[model samples]
Target: MEKHGLRERKKQRTRHALIEAAVRLFEDQGYDQVTVAEIADAAEVSPRTFFLHFPAKEDVLLADADLRVDLALRAIAERDPAEPLAGVLVRAMDQMIAHAWDSDLPTGLAALRARLAASVPALQARLLQRYLTAQADLAQALLRAFPGRLDAITASALVGAMVGAVGAAALTALRRGDGPDEVRDAMRQATALVARSVT
Candidate 1:
């Protein structure tokens, strides 16, 4: 068990190093100008190791972008069966907000990823793909968590409403150059609005 834990930690460190290196390189030279080999070298890892963690260069950005999506999905999947849909969604949104500012807030990895995705057409496409997948996953999870209480259409709509509201608020805050607190407040406010509309 200890050996497995250690191996997992080492893998996580390598992954983190690659992401940090990629972010710095992208910032200094712009995303289009940076190469996978450069990111691997900066992370002090072999190019093969980089591929082991991320399938392609574009996958790196997607990994960061999907972090919050993964968090929310996990939260929804693990929610208590008896919990209301609104309550489960609000809890998930709160987790996502916490993750948004986990590093540095105003100029953090999350912010940088969002900015890059906005300006880069390739990243924008990839983000849209993953976001749609996340929305479907969330809807499916809600259906399972709530069982007969939610139909497929209702589940989809509920997930869409929550995602749309929170995503719009977060995007607005990012564009406004809001700090971490402001971003959190915006998302929380969005969550509250959704909750009120539903219940």
Candidate 2:
């Protein structure tokens, strides 16, 4: 177990280093101009090590995205079962957003997203895939929470509505071209919409 833990920590460190290197290179010379080799060089790792850490540059940007799905499920599990699904969803969204919103606020994500938005078609596809995966995971969690009471279709519909609201709000924030405040406001509105719809 100790060896496993140490190996996991080492893996995480290498992954973090690669992401940091990618971010620096993307910021300095623009994402389009930077290559995986350059990022590996910056991180003092081989190109093979870079590939082991990230399949592509886009993966670096989305490194922690799946973590939100796990967090959302955990948040839902913590809520009162008597609470409406909408209430649970709002609470989960609040938790997830708070988890993502570091002291750096929206600037960090916005900057990274902007770079990916401009430079990588693969990143755009990955974003869509992530959203769909998140929605499916949330729907499964909702189904488990209800324990055979709610049918799959109803659960999926609920998930779809919540995901749609969040996605629309995110896009609006991205389009606004400003700071974290606007993004936060947009997400707040989205979660509120989810709560209202689910209730």
Candidate 3:
């Protein structure tokens, strides 16, 4: 058990080092020019270690994605049994958005991600891929959470609409260079709108 804890701590430290290195390199040299090898060297880790932490380079810029998925899934699974599907989804999104906000300044990772998404084709492509995967994953989780009540089609549509609404609003705010508070407000309004329609 002590060994497991040490291993996890080591992994977290390595991941943090890689993220710090990648962000600094990307800032200094731009995203497209900073290769995985360079990031690994900067982090004092092997290229293989980089892969173990992240599937691809773009993921470094969007590191919060896994946390977002896990948060949404946990919220769904742990919701009250009597809660409606829409309520569960809205709650999940609320928590996810709140997590993202975190009292960040205007020049935080959210803004950096937005800037990169607008400039870098690879980041944009990765964003699309991540969105699709997240939707599918969230839908599956929802199906499991409300087995008899929701068919695949309904589950897909509900998840799609909720995710789509939140994405659209947040992306719009990001593109407009909105600060954390503004982005949070936009996301809250978006989720509330979806809840109204779904319920």
Candidate 4:
């Protein structure tokens, strides 16, 4: 058990190192200019090891998203059944924001990822695809949580509206050169707006 725990910790450290290296390089030199091998070297790992953790360079930018989505799902699953769907969603959003603020990644990495996604067509496409998947997952979770209270269509629309609102606000903040706190504030306001509209 101790050995397994140690192995998991070591893997996590490597993953964190690679993400930090990639973010730093992408920020300093631009994402398009940075190579996988360069990111691996920056993290003091071989390219092979990097590939073990991430399928492609683009995947590194979204490495944390899977965990975030899981947290959202968990929030919905653990929420009080008597609570309205909107309230559950708000709770999930709050949890996500708290997680982002608590992440080990360097400050402004989220904004940097947003900027990169805007400028890089491939990254933008990948981000959109990921967004759609997350929306579907959230919608499904909502339907499961509320059962007869929410149909598939209503659940999907709610998820779409919530994601769209927060995404647009965050992007606008980043475009305006706002800092991380401002970006987070924008998302918070967006979340509140959606919650109010639903409930």
- Candidate closest to the true structure, highest lDDT: 4
As for candidate 4, its clashing pairs are: none
User: How does model 1 score by TM-score?
Assistant: 0.88
Per lDDT, what order, best first? 4, 3, 1, 2
lDDT of 4 at 72: 92
TM-score to true structure, per model: 0.88, 0.82, 0.86, 0.93
2 versus 4: better TM-score goes to: 4
| Backbone atom clashes (below 3 Å) for every candidate | 0, 0, 0, 0
lDDT of 2 by residue, 32-116 (tens): 7888899999999999999997778777777777777788989877778688777888877877677666522443655577457
lDDT minimum window of 10 residues, candidate 3:
102-111
Q: What TM-score does prediction 2 earn?
A: 0.82
Per-residue accuracy of model 4 over 34-139 as CA lDDT, tens digit each: 9999999999999999999998999988887888888999999999868877889999887777677666223567777877886899898888889999999999
Count steric clashes of candidate 2: 0
Task: Quote the lDDT for 117 in model 1.
Answer: 79
Encode model 3's per-residue lDDT on 21-61: one tens digit a residue: 98788888999899999999999999999999999999887
Determine the backbone clash count of candidate 3: 0
Taking the tens digit of each residue's C-alpha lDDT, what string does model 1 give over 99-164? 766753644565676788778888788778878998998899888888878899998999899888
lDDT of 2 at 110: 51
Q: Rate the local accuracy (lDDT) of all candidates.
A: 0.83, 0.77, 0.86, 0.87
Runs in model 4 lying further than 4 Å from the true structure: 104-106
TM-score, model 4 to reference: 0.93
